[model samples]
Target: MATYPQEITLKVFVNKTKNCVDFVESDLDFVDVLLSFLTLRASLKCECGGDINTSVSYDLNRDDVNYEEFRGVFIKGAKFVVTDALCISLVEDLISTLNKCVNGDRNHMEVRLVKIKREQVLRILKRSLISDTPLTDVLLQNGEGITPKFSDSLAGKKVEKKVIDKEKKVCKLNMVLTRNKVLYAVASQDFVDLIFSFLTFPLGSLKKHLGSRFRMGCLNNLYGSAERLRSSGYMTAGCAERLLNPKLAPYFNCKNQVIGVEEEKEDLYYTCNGFCKLTALYFSCKSHGYSPYHESNQVTLVDPKSQLGGTISSHGSYCQKLMYMVTDELVVTPLSLESVVSFHNEIADPIKTAELSVTEAEILDVLAVALTSNTALTDAFLGTTVGVFTSVDVKGE
Candidate 1:
């Protein structure tokens, strides 16, 4: 009656003698065929078979399902149950092979097995019936679910807790004082300005903004307080060289020098003992037994070395020479003028130099008119002097 005469067939038997029959099929359905084969051939023999009893052995030939060769056929949803069961065993073997790969025993045979198993699993999932379902869902329902290994989970949690505890510990100071010792060497105005600005700000504010240890380190290195007033153009090499000397207090007047107009004059002088060492010399002719208010008399100079090398006629030539030596020996080389000029020129606009030109005669005429009138020139050069003064002393010989 059927056109295709049931070409595929399967037979099931109860015993190894091939005498007893359990099931038989002519038009072999894929799942039925697999069940019949597994039960009859792949299954082991039993003396008293009720439902293929406990005493069973694996039939290698019949049990060996080449998943790669039949992956497409199994994935069509026609033999879903049998295909899934076969796939579970295949995946387990593949996972074992993968473990071997991780342990540095990556054999070609194991690699091929894993590849075949992966292809079969993918193929089965891609079939029309299973395509709509998630791979995770299928694995969870049929294969091993997403349960984590206890040892691995515990190790991970310990590592995470350790990391969190480390993060919770209080922060430690990690900065070094690089600029402290070097500040005296840097005498530029801009450099001094930067340092002074830092010092002038409140320590609490600085600590709050820049950190406590950093501010303390900077202050310790700076040495002097921020309240000290600096000299004009103090960033020059000369000023920087002087900063190395210690402070010195000058001597005052003796009893004889305290009378009349001499009382109004105060003797204040500075001495250089070397780097960052300065002393002020005070003299009083009235108290120290010296002559008062006399130009030619020797008043006994107390701090002759404090003069920083200027002529002292009252103290004679010998004292002058001694003072000069001390100052010269303590002198340090300042930053050169040429370097500052070069830096200034580098920052200035080249185009401004190219802009305007004026003749000397025109400048002189403009200045002459500016001096005589309260006109445009007066507004331009109101507080400024423009020319040099030449004095001619007439001497009759």
Candidate 2:
């Protein structure tokens, strides 16, 4: 077996509080204790058969920690850098010490160690070695280490390689989308577009418009063109919309409702709508394993009345009026009584329509997670018969 050098670099962020004062205060002394522990734990043998190289540095200015603070730790200034085999050892020792302190079961009198960097070890070695001798030569001569070697047969060999074309991999990812996934895709997008597209209509107008195959075809064509532009990384949905439907671009603003006017408020509505529409179109195209512009594929439907409760004329004008009157209350309401009655009679009359679709989905998700933890179930299912049982009994007399 060939061995390779494993160089690990880590940043330790220690916040000193009333609870953590012991670890931060008397920093150098605490660090020495930590270095001693790490030197043993890491099994870092020094070239000169002496103690492992390590260093300590501190910063006292306490400020709020944010993403910028993290960036500043490396960019603006680093408190310290230590490079040596013992660096990882020191980190492990400090973490163990802190874990014990936080847990409260361990004795507070136990010597607490502070973490140091691996770079510090290398710096110490570089300075200690003779100026004329190379660092690698010094370490090797002192019995520290040498480069590992692998057999030529193992190191270099010709094998079949599989290349995942992004175009194809993206297509595979799309195949995971089902109708429910499509709905999620839509919701994840710009809410403003959804409101404008579905809410402003004469209640059911949006549904009626969207439910039609012809309107769907138009959307598919438009989305297909947009997808091509997007795949080429040339234009975004808003950009494409402006390029293709320049006339409609003026009406695209949901908030201001005025052309050639810019507002201080972000155009969240339109931005959201564009994102939703683009995402839905992208996933729909991907699911079918085809480019959005594929001539044979159809546009995915967005059923506003079914998905989002709006006034549907078939549910009756009286019912529609009731919906508007009780819109706030109906927001939390279950699908309407009329719709429920219509569903049982008109949709699934003879068929036993149990609401197990959601349950089935949940079961599938659980199974996926379980399979990751327990491989036996997967192995058993591969070659054996596993019967699926139903809760409901069919005792036909």
Candidate 3:
């Protein structure tokens, strides 16, 4: 069973002069809560925040993630501050004003500890997809509201088919279209693998791909602030670059990945002649900490999930070879005649059959639609919604 504390406390730095939050200081647990918002496949929830069930609905597979596994996802024992570029600038201004103050007045700032509940966490998760100021809307404003409707520009636009060159790879999909909306699609393992890969994508990586159109609540503004800080030399080393374009962790990349995002490769390391482990950058003896260590030959690690313990033929297929039926809302299951019939019974319009040969670009479009709209299949193909089917042409052997 899924479990979390009823409430977690945070110390927020409020600027009394501006009547806004200057920054927030919290332990790793609060950071963990923030990070959890990114990993969720939350499109399943109603945009109005009505149908959200935090315990089981967010977990794609109903498995309860234990504390040890959760710890591995983020670094522990670290106290971090959450603030944007604007807040940083405000702090700098405040410091300058204080330095020149005649009375040594420090009454403009105050810190207060606030309790955030599980319901608020859910609100933040939901608002992340809709509002750009989710923290302000939920924390400071104390409102559980959401922008349920997308922009009008996205709804009525026509989806033009991009011409594919001869060398471009494609995934073949059989779509059931009716009244200008895609009812469902019959996709093979290749396409199924692509959709399943969505779970592994980081929020920053998604922002990198989607650009200004990413529009996942405060995350867009957050990523943009990070970019400005990086350009202005406010960020140290490669921290900004890593945050802006994070690569997937090792072994998480799919073999048939259509998206152009990079993934971390399994690195081979060597030990010294003294049998001390060594990395490419740092060479320290395990016994004598920080001591110089000579490099030996590289040692290869076996793929844990591979068959026969050799080079894995396939690295990331979560399911077996089977035709899958994907609904517009992204409910994926094995394709069956019975399931198709049940779906067919939901509509009463004249249906049309079309085989969509989609390339990498179209697959990315599908990803974008899945994130932004509930009618993913329809928007990816037809770019609009309409009534359902009356007559159907069911294909068979």
RMSD of each: 42.8, 27.3, 10.9
Expressed as tens digits, the lDDT of each residue in 147-194 for candidate 3 is 553333346654444456653556888788765678889999888878
Q: How do all the candidates rank in terms of lDDT, highest first? A: 3, 2, 1
Off by over 4 Å in 3: 1-126, 140-153, 157-167, 265-310, 383-397
lDDT per model vs. reference: 0.23, 0.25, 0.60
Per residue, candidate 1 scores C-alpha lDDT tens digits across 1-397 of 6632122222221222322221221111232222211121101111112322221222212334553333221121111211212221122324554456335532221211011122223232222111222222223233234232111111111111111322221111111011111001212222222211221222222223222122122221222211121222212233322222211122221111111111113344432222122224332233333333321222334434235465432221111111110010111223455643443354422211111122222222222222112231222122122221112211111
TM-scores for all candidates? 0.12, 0.16, 0.62
TM-score of model 1 relative to the true fold? 0.12
- Flag the better candidate by lDDT, 1 or 2: 2
Model 2 regions lying over 4 Å from their true place: 1-217, 223-238, 241-348, 356-397
Q: Give the per-residue lDDT of model 2 (tens digit) for 1-397.
A: 9943323222322222322223233212222322232112111212322333322233323333342234221022112222212121123335666576557634332333333244433432332222222221222233244332211111122211223233111000001111111101111112222222222221112212222211212222223433343455434234432222222211222322211111122122211222333332343333334444432322333222232554322111111212211111112122356643443354221222111111222212222222112231222121111122233322211
Best by TM-score: 3
Worst 10-residue lDDT window, candidate 1: 175-184
